[model samples]
Target: MDYFDPAGFCKVGDEAGFRNLRAAELKHGRVAMMAALGASVQHYVQFPGFDEVPTGIGAVTTAPGSYGFAALFLVSGVLELALWTEDPKKEPGNFGDPLNLGQYDIDMRNKELNNGRFAMFSIVGIIAAELFTGKDGIDQIGLDTPTL
Candidate 1:
């Protein structure tokens, strides 16, 4: 019943395996954070021509039609094959900061990892709540109400 592994479920047996796991977790967290942001933004903002698109889950289901899915698949494949090829010598998620965004210390890295993990859970909860309640995140949490 360790603080980090209360279930004893983390079975990474070696450093290399742990690095790979961290990299995967980081990548998934980044995607989840973006998805959660996109879902929230969709409630308040949309492109000019996309007015007909429904909000919430309907928007996710409808906007990405067959062609969109195909394009996404192809582009994702290219990026994964070309850009995301991992380097074993590099640190787990240290795919260099291109913007020269100042120092990236261990503290910053841990914060990013923790935030990403939280976001992963958040996105899942958001989708589940929307599915069960039939309401967007804002309405689901009563944020739609206005008070004076």
Candidate 2:
């Protein structure tokens, strides 16, 4: 997985240079997969109660913001990962017509980027709503702390 360490890569200056290079690429991919797995696990761990969806709109706004945040992360991650491609020709069948190439067409790329922006904005709004109902200034509009 040594992308920068010159000495870490397989012997690539000899007759088997191509093989060594391929081997190095495979190693790098393995390292990447392991890193992504760790990150994904961490992301899931942050949301302890994902299965419990609130019954209504008020319940949704008050029942731990982590629920919505986690859902957004999971959904967007799936969409982005599905669109990932280092080689356009080898993209999966579900990605759409291969004729409209460029690894990912502008429309697909925009969708991925916009999903991320939407998630960020949604999280910010969630936090702002939480803050508004916190013990400081502001009205008691949020259900996070109902007087009853």
Candidate 3:
């Protein structure tokens, strides 16, 4: 799509403008999605033998960590909101409901957990591969003996 170049209105190193500018906004979101996906994929590899847990219950090995992280995230997020975000609790508008804080924290925490799922997968894949290759034993490691 051909469009007007807004470089005339954009200044170098203007991050806010760079992020908000029309052209930049579209590209920024795409790049952000790609980077986040890559990071999430890497995160999945952090858990070793997580899938070894049984068919039904094995999957939960990571759940507790995810849950713990989520809880911490919620608690910290609320504090951050109180510090950085507008104190809706003190505001007079209808948008400022203190009770909404808990819900918002939960919602935000869930999102974080969901986004980290990809990383969890990637990590598991790598660890499983390693174990399957006999790396799980200390006596034997890499198969780089030049043997066919």
Candidate 4:
């Protein structure tokens, strides 16, 4: 499957398509978007057979693969309010089913917030500390040394 491209993420951030989306969808916009994205990942995790795995990526097995999952629960919490907030054309009730949260608007607002590019990156900062504490001298002991 194709992953999201940051380069083209702006394509969805148009005036007409996402005009005042923050004001309209508010917090629900991000939540709705995340629900959709999360569902996609879940699909990949559940049905990662030959047809599901992408071409040239080799097979999808437990052979040491790394994937990242991070989203701004901040924006999602905001969006939950957005969906039911005042709208001239809409009512102040569940715009969607309580069971269905809908999909992401796929704009820069969500992408930037979800990615480490924006928001408080304290986790990244803390994890970077490991750079100075590498696995030093551990590999030099050709095999197990004798007990003292």
Best-fitting candidate, measured by lDDT? 1
lDDT (Cα, 0-100) at 99 in candidate 1: 85
Off by over 4 Å in 1: 1-13, 63-73, 145-148
- Local distance difference test values of all predictions, in order: 0.75, 0.42, 0.41, 0.35
RMSD of each: 4.1, 13.1, 15.0, 15.1
What alpha-carbon RMSD in Å does predicted model 1 have with respect to the real structure? Answer: 4.1
Global fold similarity of model 3 (TM-score): 0.22
Error of 1 at 31 (Å): 0.7
Can you tell me which runs of candidate 4 are displaced by over 4 Å?
1-19, 23-87, 91-94, 97-148
Quote each prediction's TM-score: 0.81, 0.24, 0.22, 0.20
lDDT of 3 by residue, 1-148 (tens): 1123455665766644533453333333434444445333432333453333221112233564555456756886786467534322431111234676555344553454344445455445544654566332111233323211
Which of the predicted structures, 1 or 4, would earn the higher TM-score when compared with the native? 1
On a 0 to 100 scale, what is the lDDT of residue 148 in model 2? 14
Clashing pairs in 3: 40-119, 43-119, 44-119, 44-120, 44-121, 44-123, 45-123, 53-58
Off by over 4 Å in 2: 1-104, 134-148
Worst 10 residues of 4 by lDDT: 135-144
- List residue ranges in candidate 3 displaced over 4 A: 1-44, 47-62, 86-148
Q: State each candidate's clash count.
A: 0, 0, 8, 6
